[model samples]
Target: MATYNLNDIVLGVDIGGSHITAAIINLKEKKEIKSTWNRNLINAKGTSHQILQGWASTILQSMESVETKPEKIRIAMPGPMDYETGICLIQDQDKFRSLYSLNIKELLAAEIGYDPADISFHNDAACFLKGELYGGSLYGFDKAIGLTLGTGLGTSYTSSGKAEDADLWNMGFLEGIAEDYISTRWFVKRFYELTGKQVADVKELIDNHAGSTDFYQVFSEFSNNLASFIYQFIQRETPLAAVIGGNIAHADTYFMKETQQELNELLGYSFPVKKSFLGESAILLGAGAST
Candidate 1:
C-alpha cells in the first residue's frame, strides 16, 4: 500500500440522472487524484436499493483505489433534496423517482460502513460554481453565476465566497418554465420540430446535423433563448461573471458566440461569460472542498 496524507484526502461524488462519478480529491492541492477517479452507469428508475448500491459501489471503487481512507465523503446531487437532512424530495422529474423522500446520507453510509456524520450532500449546481470559484474559471471573481446545461438546467449564484442554488429551473419563461426552453430536451424537441427527426441529446444533434442549415437554425434559436434567460438572470443577481458547464456545453462553438452577442445587445455592454475549465472535475473538487 502506498502512503498518503490522509488529512487532505476526501471522496467526492457527483450523482447525475444516469451515472455516478466519484474520485479522491486532495483539498490541500485543490484537485482530484486522477488515478482514483471512477464512474458507473446507473438506472435512475431502478429500485432504491439498486440506485444506492450502484452509487456506493462506485464510491468504494474510488476510495479503494488509494491506500488512505478519505476523511469524509461529500456528494454533489440534484435536487429537490434536503441538503441539510439528506432526504431526497425529488418527484415528477422522470428520474430518481424511487428515491423520493429517502434519506440518502444514512442509506449510503450504511452501504459504505461509514458513520452517517461522515457523509454530506449538496446541490450539484452550487458545487459546480463552488468548484469554479475555488480554482477554475471563476476563481478570481468575487461574484458569479454558474449554469450547468445537461439533461436538465442547473443554476447557482455565488458572492463573497458563498455559493447557493439559484433555483431558477422552474422560473416562469415564455410558455412553460426556464428549463423547458434551455435544456437538452429543448434541443431534441426543437430539432424534431424543425426536421421531424429524433436525437437522443445535443451530442447526437451536433454529430448528425453539424453544418446543415437546420443545424444553424436550431442553434440560432437556442442562442436567442439563452440570451433572453441570461438577461433575466443578470437583472436579478448582477453577478460579476458567469461560467457554464455540463455535457451540452461541450458544443459551445455552436451557440456561445451568438448567445454572448445577443446578451450584449440586450444589456448594452459586454458581460463576462466563460466555459468551465475543469469540466466534470469541478463537481468533484467542489464536493471535496465543501468537506
Candidate 2:
C-alpha cells in the first residue's frame, strides 16, 4: 500500500436511484477517510432542479466533513449515461427521469460551485468492482466479477486493474431477462406470487419474516437462482472469484451459504462467492480509485 498526502485526496460520490453518498479517499493509500463519509436520502421523483439541489446539499455535507476542500471529484452513477461526457441518458427507468439527457456534471457543478471539468464519472457497477479490486476482497485477484444485488442486478468485471460494466442485466435468461430473476424485484415478485403478500422489498420480507419457513424457502430459491446466474457468467468469463455487494447483501447470512453450495456442486469445486466487506463504502472507494 502506498501513502498519500492530504492534498492528493479526491472526493468520491455514489449516486443511486433513491440516495447519494460521498466521501474523500486518499488515492495513494487507496483508503477512504472515514471522517469524510456522508450519505443522504434523495427523492428521485423530484423535479430536475430539486434533485440537483438535494444532491448538492448532500455533497456539501460530505465535503464539510473534511478540512481542506476537494479540488477534484469522481462520481459512480448508474446508466444509460455517457461517463466520458458526464451526461445522464437515463429515461423511463423509474428514477431520475427528470435528469434524462441532462449533463449531470455540468448541472451538479453549477449547483455546487465547482468547475465541471474537475469532475469525472464512471459506471456505478464498474466503480463497485474497482473498489473491491483495489482495496476489498478482490484485491489479490486479477480477473473477477462483481454483482451489486439491489433494485437491479449491477454487474461488473475487472482484469489487470481495469474495471468495466458487464451490461448483462438485460440479457436473455430463464423465461425473461437476467435481472428478472436476479434483482430485488425478483424477490418481491416471487414472494408475492407465492404468498400473495405485497412486501416493499426483500429487506422488508427478511426483516418481517426471516424465521418463517415461507420466506426461508424464498431465500433458498433466490440463492439457487443467483447461483445459476453466477454459473453462467463464470463459464463465460472465467473470473477468479465473484464478489457481491448492494442492499440485498445485508441478508448474505441467510442466502449466501446456499448460493456457494449450489455453485460448488455445479462447478465441482469451491468457487468463491464473497459478499462485499466494504459494503456501501465500496462505491466511494471505487469512484476515488477511478479518479
Q: List, residue by residue over 61-86, the lDDT tens digit for candidate 1.
A: 88776778886899999888999889
The count of backbone overlaps in candidate 2 is: 0
Return the clash pairs for model 1, or none. none
lDDT of 2 by residue, 180-202 (tens): 88888788888888888889777
Q: Which runs in model 2 stand beyond 4 Å of their true positions?
A: 1-6
lDDT of each: 0.91, 0.86
User: Which predicted model would earn the best TM-score?
Assistant: 1
List candidate 1 stretches off by more than 4 Å. none
Cα lDDT of candidate 1 equals 0.91
What TM-score would each prediction reach against the true structure?
0.96, 0.93
Report the C-alpha displacement of residue 88, candidate 1, in angstroms.
Answer: 0.5
Per-residue error for 163 in candidate 1, Å, reads: 1.0
